[model samples]
Target: MTGSLTIGTLAKQAAVNVETIRFYQRRRLLDEPDKPPGGIRRYTQTHARRIRFIKEAQKLGFGLDEVADLLALEDGRHCREVEEIAGHKLAVVRERMTQLSKIEKLLVVLVGRCHGNSGKVRCPLIASLESATA
Candidate 1:
């Protein structure tokens, strides 16, 4: 924890797989430390922090592309830009919630219909899905 961390240690500390770290490196989301001739590459606490930041951002519904934008605006001076990005993400989350709620309601009705059936008959859920528009 005091000295530089190897890639495996960094991955463990960052709660991500080694492949994920490489993916982030390829995406330019994380910096790839220089390799010393025959020496292994090592990461710093800063890199660990950045990985955590990326993961947290993704948990809040930001995709990698959006996470990149968030990373770019991470500097304290970009408060307004960050807000704009967050505002957009909020709108997307709200819309997804609305869609999910609608789907939940439909599933409840369809499941209830199927559950209430006492005899062997056609499934209401299948019928509904077949008749569903769009």
Candidate 2:
């Protein structure tokens, strides 16, 4: 707290790995702080917060590019644009859910056919995948 924090300190506070912070820097999602003369660069709490925000956004299925747009909206001038972006993301989520449900149904049927008494030569899971492609 006396001086600015180092990358390790920022990573610890953000609850992420040091390499993750570096990756964010490389991706331009987080800014690299300037190093002082004969000293290492230090990150402020804002950097830690931004890293947390990016991680949380990713957990919610937002890609890095979308997270960057969300960060822009956090700048207080793009409040109105957030809704449009979120709506599009919701539509995408719904589509993925539909696709996942279809996959789940197929997996259920495939698993049901595996009576566990058959030899490995007749594996239903492999059969299902092969048939789908054919």
Tens digits of per-residue lDDT, candidate 2, 48-104, equal 889989988898688999888777666655545768876777787786676566667
lDDT tens per residue, model 1, 7-106: 9999999999999999999999988999999999988999999999999978877789988977776644466777887788778888767666666777
**Which has the greatest lDDT?**
1
Residue 118, model 2: lDDT of 77
Q: What value does the lDDT take at residue 19 in candidate 1?
A: 98
Question: Model 1: C-alpha RMSD to truth?
Answer: 5.1
Compared to the true structure, candidate 1 yields what TM-score? 0.59
Q: What's every prediction's RMSD, in angstroms?
A: 5.1, 5.6
Candidate 2 ranges beyond 4 A from true positions: 76-134
lDDT of each: 0.81, 0.77
